[model samples]
Target: MLMIRPSFDTLYEALLTRDPSYEGRAFVCVSSTGIFCRLTCPARKPKPENCTFHETVAECMAAGFRPCKRCRPTMPEASADPVVKPLVEALEKRPGHRWGEPDLVRMGLDPSTVRRAFKRHFGMTFLEMARQRRLQEGFSALADGGKVIDAQITAGFESPSAFREAFAKILGQAPGAFSSKPLLFADWVATPLGPMIAVTDRTQLHLLEFLDRKAFPAEFRKLQTYARGEIGFGRTDVSDQIQAELDRFFSGTGASFETKIALHGTAFTRDVWRELIGIPAGEIRSYSEIARSLGRPQAVRAVARANGANQIALVIPCHRVIGADGSLTGYGGGLWRKQRLIELEQGYRAKG
Candidate 1:
């Protein structure tokens, strides 16, 4: 799965509007201009048909696109300017500091000015920027076997209630929802497609899905129940392995996954997923074909249902399953991604 990309038209529109959300996540390679630029690049916007979007700068370079001088696509992404640098450095140096406007004032910065500047540049307030940074750091600490007290302190939250409230405010879930010693942990994996949310234990990857799915919240709750509520914020050995394999897969250099996966679905669903994986990279299988292969020719609908129920996206290879008529069918991550994956696989296969 890549960044949660929209249709080409939508991306073109975002490029026209200079949507900052896509700054580094998506790149537009302009054939006419002979260069690729950030979506927010100030150069004269190119025509829509001349635009080709790639998930990473590496792709743009591979396709012979030089970075735009206006947007500086290859540069580090810290709100696109040096203004946020000092504030960010301050937060990192003192993650446990109680950040407030008065503190900014004492630091010789105007409160309203800083807030407006950050809001315009990063789509977040100055304090919000700090909170988010601290939250990620705190989650990292908690994932590394640190105590909750230590996690909060490391996150710069002076009180447990403050930390819990901040966590709940960002995640929209209770911070106390996990077991004392979690058997499962959830962390993020950055991909060319976007970011994938991964649920894993110390040994096996359980669930992996795109972050923007409409059914993600419910899917996470269901995973929590399947893991007997032993979910927390953290990274595991399996997640590290999964990310590495996925990186290779997306780079088109490897088509196999060596990491173990824990399937929490029904027996039929697991069977369907295993069959999906066996279909091979750069190939497609119809639902009926899969049902027949499973020795249950009448279970075509069941096969499709199981395909839909697959939580692990690229690893399970649900996108490999297509309509009986050879049309793209429903994909939890969207059909555009399915089409992209098929094209990618077919292209690699053709080259091989």
Candidate 2:
């Protein structure tokens, strides 16, 4: 069943009365307090002008409102489901543990049922989420300047070689390959959708990609060759600047990126990226449309390739590009993330 969002008056009345009928169906984002709450929240209500209603926690977050502590509006709606609650709690408690069907079976739960429950509530199976967490742990360890053995143990890898293989497969280089003394630095920045790896020098942001992107390894190698500097796990003032900008972006407070970025691409590709940056938030353009805007109407294919060639993610706004037929084309960060980003920017458009 499609759950439509309640009208503003309907939601305000519910909030004033602490109505339970709209418990999970509606949420309130308060501009004055910078927080979101459930209609049933026991805390004091804000003035009507300060309140904006949304249908989901994601929408509230996209508007830059943090969850209300008094009501815990960020809690999953399915947390009370018998099959989901315990498993979620277990995952939280054992984040680094490798979870599998056998583990669910040992817990006297049907693995298939568990998978379905998690996918319905979280948009991913429990095992997939668990693996992502494990990868985060390993990445965090390395970001902290820990050794390969330290990261392996922290990530729950069975052996050094196992950890290195997995790291190389994802990052395109083994942890050991990074130099202790280096000219360029890399760091991890956590985002609402996932973790992103940020590469920067002292002055300009060099690259930023979601850690899971399949092309990241090759992208990293290419950047290393171009910079003629060893890359290491460290942060620069530029990294700090981009992290702050990203925090504001996901919080829905602001979308403008002021971080200086080093654009490493051919002249044509650079022109395409500059055009992409011209795309306004909450708007989309087709590859052919981008080409035409650049006064190269016959270069539609080239526009698409240049879009794909963009190494910087949100800063470049490459996700704003679509197929000529208005279909979402491939994004290196995965189409799912691309969709979420587009949705998130709609909040920006609304506010503007």
Candidate 3:
């Protein structure tokens, strides 16, 4: 992936020029509207301080901004073109499929047209998306203790070499190169709202994060590196324990988590996360208060960053963090979720 740095001057210039070239490459996040827009948006431009640029829709979404209605920043005009919809739907249906040019031809579609359609819609070709999906599934399976061959088959790779190449391409390592130890393992846990990934070692749980979280991949990579190729599938005793606890949590039987956690962070970060665990089910704390509790009243920003870096969702209690003004702040899982989580916890507390 190419890292495109946001240039305010250049992006503003594009906005001013209404340059079609910048339509898919750049987006403007508006502070006033709490939304982001493509450079080609017809709305009057906002001040520089009120504008932030992003390279991808995922980045904009991760930052807690909505797509502008006027601009329709998220779905470019090309995406809505009739030729693309079928290919997009097919890709979505079997994301794990090993798609090639022949596969497209077999499907009675022109490969180049499909590629162009995907590029226009998602900023990547259908092949690339399929490859990424396969890798993601394989990674999840491996983390859940699936055998190497099983992971390969699950990913729809006909050969081990192809599977390994795809895995290394996305995750920077081959499947077998990852940890085979019984240490900490992670897997996707489907929920009503969305899928969440959970990680656990033999004696304690480690991470639980929503699948859609942009920070999730980076955090999982960090954990994989920390495990030094020792991570593998199959649940640890601790993982099973946490799974049961999570079951209770969702079933409304309880909102309590007693799973041991293997926290990975600096002393200060750990302190902030520990405080999050202490927040009552129905209660919340401002970032400023959390910083003060850590004896660093001025470290509110640092506290917020640590909170953002937290991988263990719900369990570590990072969702309890709010803005200083008692407003909902940044949540990796999305603000709608944060509000719902707070409400759920409040209901749980009330019942208790």
Candidate 4:
């Protein structure tokens, strides 16, 4: 297999900043220390002259660098985090347990320390992570057409209202609001970055957004209304197809998303998205550049609005748009994810 890696300077910059977004995507080997560490490693930084970057731990080992004890770049990420490992293991053991700060106290862990550690590793506080997991359980049950009470029990929510509120917060509707027989289906698709909700009809995908995105609820509500409350929890043939394509993309074997997608935007917004789709995997463009391509050089702000209004993620390639100064700007999935996505696509460019 070809080794997919970002640019040398990019990896070096990640090493310098200890950027956690590059955690599994890249590793650094320090010649002076004879060891390799994760980009988020806490060890003292070495001079650039002594640094070598690799795409995988095996490559670092092949280059004669042992894994650093501090970061344990060779181990799975959760194992390297003192606070994340046990808590994650506990979560797996009891998927239905509602976690709180008091639970951290019972485990002899400081709540503040636990919060910071989980956020650093998982991009969410431990309580939030726990809540997401519980919701996943409930969502899965509901997707199978189980009763609301069954989902609440599966999610370990003692109060029915609490489960309903949580579900509403995520999907913009309570369990009863969803149609039992519906024209659209929504299901979770796990990716290397995070879990994304894919809403599709029988053939075309309508919406695809990261679950943790701040804009997801509003976007989903808009989608829900557009579908006339006919969205249900389930998967379609299109869902299976996208999942396989996503697997290949993350595995570096393929980067194509061939599933037919439905566009629900104004004519200009649709045109902007079509232009974004034309951008090569390894390349990036700015809003002004996109506007110029569309023969509306003055529509830079409108181009930006179209970019932000993108409902489908990687498929539409909104992350490919950057500031004219080459800075990453606001991304609905978070800037960290945008940076990591750009880095990942650079590998695809290298392969081609």
Off by over 4 Å in 2: 1-94, 104-110, 113-124
Q: Pick the candidate with the highest TM-score.
A: 2
| Alpha carbon lDDT of each predicted model | 0.74, 0.80, 0.72, 0.80
TM-score of each: 0.61, 0.72, 0.59, 0.71
Per-residue lDDT of 99-187 in model 3, one digit per residue for the tens?
Answer: 78898788788888877876756566767666655655665567656788988987888899988886665444576865665466755
State the lDDT at 124 in candidate 2: 58
Q: Tell me the TM-score of model 1.
A: 0.61
Runs in model 4 lying further than 4 Å from the true structure: 1-93, 101-129
- Specify the poorest-scoring 10-residue window by lDDT in model 3: 186-195
> In model 4, what is the error at residue 4, expressed in angstroms?
12
Candidate 3 lDDT (Cα, 0 to 1): 0.72
User: Model 4, 79-197: lDDT tens per residue?
Assistant: 76887778877876676789888999999999999888766654457686566557667887887789889999989999999988988887777887888888999987756566688
**Models ranked on TM-score:** 2, 4, 1, 3
Look at candidate 2 and tell me the lDDT of residue 6.
56
2 against 4, candidate with superior lDDT: 4
Q: 1-352 in candidate 2: lDDT tens per residue?
A: 1166555677789999998888777888765455679899999888775666767655554334555667866455877888877776786566667788999999889998988987676455778767766776677678778888888887878887888898889778889988788788988765656557889988999899887788888999999898674888887888777876776676566799999989999999999999999998899999989999999999999999999989999999999898878889899999999999999899999998
